[model samples]
Target: MNNLLIGYARCSTDKQDLQIQRETLTSLGVAADRIYCDHGLTGTKRDRPGLTQALAAVRGGDTLVVAKLDRLARSVPDARWIAEQLTERGVRLQIGASVYDPTDPMGKMFFNILATFAEFEADLIRLRTREGMKRAKAQGKLRGKQPKLSSMQYKELRRMYDSGDYAISDLAEMFRVSRATIYRSLERTPVSR
Candidate 1:
């Protein structure tokens, strides 16, 4: 069987475009029909429909092409594991921008080094986020959204409740507040003019 060039493209959100990646793969000699695309999905997920289909279609000695290393996955461990899987199945993994190729010994070494760096960068980001959250909590800066209802609004809510024209849930929905907020407002003394 002739070696087939398969491409995979993914975008994290529906608003983002996958065309550039697709075009890059096509320019690199992958046929338009051979490119599989997944949109509005996260790379963190393992069960992507397009990715699964692309993997299933690939046979031994096939080349699986991606626009970039990150386009395949962000996690270094996951990336390494995926490379291993492809190699075990006799599939060659190629990154358009990276010198790392699973088919070559030097490329494999370079890929491992790059994966290690990616892992280190991810750890740093997680550590920085944790420290920032700790500082914010210490300063009492962590807070939820403020209540939307004003005292006058509370009065109106009570008046509407007294009318009994709407159910509790219905009143909550109409006011755009939660049922708990409505019940709490009902417990308060209605303000006089």
Candidate 2:
């Protein structure tokens, strides 16, 4: 049976471009049709549909290709798990231009090290983001989403509603806000019994 190259690529955010990885895989001799991709999916996730398809496409004597180790799996345990599965299925893993030999002791160590680094990098990013948000908040720069209307605006909106001179739709149009916003604003004031 002829061996085939099944390529997989992923990006955690839709904003991230998978074009480079696709180009890299194509350059590595994988046919465009043979490539599967996951957009807005993180490496920390194991249930990626693209990864599943890629793995399923590879049979004995077939190779699974990824642009990088982190693109395949982020955690050490997940990496080892995938490696073991491939080894048992007699499938080879190609990371970029390098073929990872899971049977070799040194190869296993290297793979584990790479996975550890990927996990560490993800953790550091989370830590840095939290720290930055905390600092921003302390400086009063991170007050999330300012209210659409001021307290005075709410009072005026409520007064107009109580006057009964304007319809709800008219009030919304006059205030340049939605009917729901008008309702919410009016609700904020207690009704007089």
Candidate 3:
């Protein structure tokens, strides 16, 4: 069918619902049969089966539509690559009401700008998360995960390691942990008596 509209929707986790995206795409005139969805898959993952299928199904004049650009990809490289792929295939990509016309230089520029903003937003989120963690640590509220072993246990581990009588595997078996955990415990300072 010429001038077909195909839609894509994605949810990042199993707990998330794709209903909102589905509704939006349906309202935008994408037929149910024309809609593809990737469930419980991150935008960063390149192996999304639904996206692969959607891309494979598009024809020269067909439009691939999404509720939002982020639903397509959060990384600029991935977004730009996908846009280039569509351009090469003579397919149009649309996000909400905005369409990216690969034939138009201004449309390509706008799509690049959009992808840059998306990448920037992701970096800002990461920076904010790191800063928040640093502030929490400064306030003494950001202790990481509780230690798997107690101080006494760690001290005992170090003593056992230094004695050379027990193998790392033996210590791991004794402590009911992996050899890596035993090794990590051995690196701790000896506990005071």
Candidate 4:
């Protein structure tokens, strides 16, 4: 199985092309049939069918190849998990021109450092998003989508519901809103606006 090389490629969506990764794998001498791809699927998701198939097809001594580290996984833990699985199965992991050798201390150190950077990058993005949301709220532009019913309309609906003359279904129908919406309206405190 040492001669057997399996390649995997992924794109975030159907609109994205796998051609570049495919060409890279081909140039690396992996047969077209041996290459697997997940289209319109995010790298962050572990449930990719194409990746599952490629892993299943791997045999002892076979090499799993990808064009880049991110193409294989989006996070550090995920990349490490895949690498561990390959090591357990006696399969080699290759990224672009370099083959990862976990047994080599330098290689292990390099991969760990790279994975840490990827995780740090993701964390930074999340922090920036939180800051942006805070800024929006400060500007009074952070209100979510407007309610289906205006404040006055909701007050009227509440009054009708409290009277107990109308069934919830009937009120929902009259208001042209879902029963859940009516229940939510009943639960809410009076809105000034």
Kindly give the stretch of ten consecutive residues in candidate 4 with the minimal lDDT sum: 184-193
Model 3 per-residue lDDT tens digits across residues 147-187: 88888888888888788799999988888999989867766
Best by TM-score: 3
Report clash pairs, candidate 3.
none
Winning candidate number (lDDT): 3
**Per-residue lDDT tens digits of candidate 4, residues 66-151?**
88877878788887887777767778778888886654678677777777776777678779999999999899989867897888
Q: In candidate 3, how many Å is residue 11 off?
A: 1.7
TM-score (all chains, Cα) for each model: 0.62, 0.71, 0.88, 0.76
Ranking by lDDT: 3, 2, 4, 1
- Candidate number that wins on TM-score, 1 or 2: 2
Pairs of colliding residues, candidate 4: 13-40
- Count of backbone clashes, every candidate in sequence: 0, 0, 0, 1
Candidate 2 per-residue lDDT over residues 1-193, each given as its tens digit: 6589999999989999999999999999999999999999988888899988888888888889999877888888888888888887888788999986667788778778888898898789899999999999999999987767888887777777777788999988998989888888777775533
Please provide, for model 1 over 53-169, each residue's C-alpha lDDT reduced to its tens digit, 9 standing for 90 to 100.
888878888888888766677677777877787777778877884434576788678777766776676668779988998888789896546767887788788778888787889
Off by over 4 Å in 1: 97-104, 117-193
